[model samples]
Target: MNREDFWEIVERSRAEVGDTRDAASAAAVARHVVARLTALGPSTAVEFQHFYEALNEESYRWDLWAAAYLMRSGCSDDGFDYFRGWLVAQGRVVWEQAVADPDSLAAVGVDPDDDMVDCEAMVAAAGDAHATSTGDREAFWAALEQTEGDDEPAAPADPAGEDFDFDDDEQMRARLPRLAAVYRPVQ
Candidate 1:
C-alpha cells in the first residue's frame, strides 16, 4: 500500500481502539494490525520503529503487540536482538538504582509475593516516553543521517503501487462495516 493509505489504516485502527478494555475487542484489534502488517510485505527495522511510535502515541496496546509480533515473526534475529538490548538496558537502570540504594525499591513498595517487578510495564513506560518526545522524529532522522554518512546512496522504495485512502469516506464506509462484524466498537 502507498504511504497515505497505510497511514489511513493506522489512524482508523487507532480510532477503533477508543477506550476498549475487553479482551476479545483487544484481540480483534491486534489481529487487524497483524493482517495489515502482513499485507504490507517485507518491512525494515526503521519502518517497524515508526509503526511502534505511532501506535504508542495513540495508546493502542493491540497495535503495539501486533507490531512486536510482526517484528518477531518476519525478522526473528533482528527483533530478538533489539528486544533483548532494550530489556538489558532497562534491567541495568533498575538494578543499578536498586543496588545503589535499596530504599529506591521501598519507594515503589515491592510486594514480597511478586517475585519480579513487571518488566513489560517498564518497557511499555519507556516506549511511551520515547513516543511522546518531541525530539524523537528528529533523533530518528539524525540516526539515519549518521548512517548515510557522505555516501548519498539512493534507496529503493516499495513496489506495490496501491494507495491507502484512510480519509476517504467511501473507503471507510466499505471497510468499517466488514471490520465491525469482527471488531465491536470500543465502549
Candidate 2:
C-alpha cells in the first residue's frame, strides 16, 4: 500500500471507533483495520505493513521522542515505538504536523490518563491483518521481505538529529517549549 492508502485505512478505523482512544479503543481500531485489509487481499495487506514500518522509521526523531517522553511523563524505547503508532493513528494531518514540529503535538488533545499515547495495538494493526490475510505471521513477513527488499524502511542507527536528555527539564523546555508548556516537565 502507498502512504495515502495506509493513512486511509487508519482514517477508516478511527471512524469505525468514532475517533475514540485508550487501550480498548486502540484494539478496536486494530480489529477494524484487520477487517479492512483482509478485504483488500493479502498482497495489499503486506504492503500496508511496509508503509507502517516506513512511517515509523520516518517518525523516529529525537525531537519527537522528547515530545512523547514529556506527554507520557517518561517514555522508554518501546514506549516511543507505541507513541509513534499512536501518532499514525491520529491520521495524516496530525502525523505530518508532529513530524514537522514535535511541539505541534501539544495541541493533539491526549487522553486524560495518556493510555492513547501508548497505543501498542495501533502498531500491531497491519501485522495482525497481514497474518489474517496470509494465514501465517511468518508467511506475511517473508512476503514483506521479498516485495519490500531494498525499499523497506530500515531502522535508523540513531534517531535522526541531535540527541538530548529527554528527562531533563531545561533541555525539554528549550527544545520543545510548546509541549513542555502543555505537559510541564517534572522538575
Candidate 3:
C-alpha cells in the first residue's frame, strides 16, 4: 500500500478501538495491524518491529505493536528505552519546531510564547488523557494537550460526576479548543 493507503488503514484500525474493549476486540485490532503489515510485504521480524516502532511515532495504537515487536524480536529492554527516548526527542523536536515557526501554532489556535512551557509535560498529559478517553473526543483531547508546559499530576476524577461519552468525532473536535486551552503556556 502507498503512504496514504497505509495511513488510512492505520486510522481505520484506530477507529475500531473502543472505550471498553475486551481481549477479543484487542486481538481483532492486532489482527488488522498484522494484516496491513503483511500486505505491505514480508520482512524479518526485527524489521517489522522497527516499522511498527516508527509508526507508533504517529499512530498511538502502534505503541502496542512496537512492544510486541520488541518482545518477538528479543529486544524488549531496547525497545522500551528506544520508545522512551524517541518520545522525549519528539517532544523536544515539536517544541523547537513550534518555537522556530510560531505561526504553526495558529493552525491549532495556540499563540506562540516567548517563554514556552515544558513540551514533554504537555505531551504526557495529553497522552494520559487520550489513554483514558474514548472515541474521537479522546483523539481531540490528546491532540489539544500536545503543547509546551510543565508536567503536572492529573486531577482525580470526581466519583459523583457523570462520565462524558467520547464516541463522536464532531464532539471531539468541538472539545479540542477547550483541551488545548488548558495546556496553553503562560507568556
Candidate 4:
C-alpha cells in the first residue's frame, strides 16, 4: 500500500479503536493490516515493515523521548516504539511536525482533555506481523538491522560545563515546556 493508504488504515483503526494503547485496538489494526496485505500479495508485508521502520527512525529524537517520558514516566527502547506509533496515530499533520522537529510538538495545539492517544499498539502490531510472516527470526532482525541501522548515536557533550539530565522529570519539563504542557497527564 502507498503512504496514503497506509495512513488511512492507521487513522481508521484509531477512529474505531480510539486509543491505540488499548490492547484490543492495537490488535484490531494489526489484524486489519495483515488481512489487507493478502490482497496485495506477499511483498506488501515487506513494504509495510519498511514503512514502519522509517516511521520509527523518524521519531528517534531527544525531544520526543522527553515527551514520552512525560506521558509514561520513563520511556524504554520499546516505549519509544509505542511513542512513535502514538505519533503516527496523531495523523499526518502531527506526525509530520514531530518528524521535522520533535520540539515543535510543544507549539502544536492539542486538546489536553482528550484521552491518551496510543498509536504504538498499531505500530508494534505491524512490526510483529512482519517478523512472524516469514517465521525466520534471525533473518528478520538481520534485515531490520541492515535497513534501520543503529539507533542515532549519542550527541557529544558540550565543552562548556553545562550538564543535561535526561532522567530528571523536572529538567525535561523545563526543557520542553510546550510538549510537557500538552502531554503531561492530568492527575
> How would you order the candidates by TM-score, starting with the best?
2, 4, 1, 3
Query: lDDT per residue, candidate 2, 53-165, as tens digits?
Result: 88888898999999988887788899999888777767789889999999998777775356447678777776777788677988886887788677544588899989998
User: Model 4 over residues 80-162: C-alpha lDDT tens digits?
Assistant: 66667767655667788776656676554444444343555556554455555665545555655565546744333321223
Tell me the spans in candidate 1 whose CA falls farther than 4 Å from its real position: 1-7, 11-19, 44-48, 54-187
TM-score, one value per model: 0.25, 0.90, 0.24, 0.62
TM-score of 2: 0.90
Tens-digit lDDT track of model 3 for 142-181? 3434431356333333312223333333432343333223
Query: Could you tell me which 10 consecutive residues in candidate 1 have the lowest summed lDDT?
Result: 59-68
Model 3 misses residue 31 by how many Å?
A: 1.2
Ranking by lDDT: 2, 4, 1, 3
What lDDT is reached at residue 35 by model 1? 44
TM-score computed on alpha carbons, candidate 1? 0.25
- Better TM-score candidate (2, 4): 2
Q: Assess each prediction's global lDDT (C-alpha) against the native.
A: 0.34, 0.80, 0.33, 0.60
lDDT digits (tens) for residues 46-88 of candidate 1: 3534444432233222222222222232223234333322222
Question: Could you tell me which 10 consecutive residues in candidate 3 have the lowest summed lDDT?
Answer: 114-123
Estimate the overall C-alpha local distance difference test score of candidate 3. 0.33
Residue 112, candidate 1: Cα error in Å is 27
Model 4 worst lDDT window (10 residues): 154-163
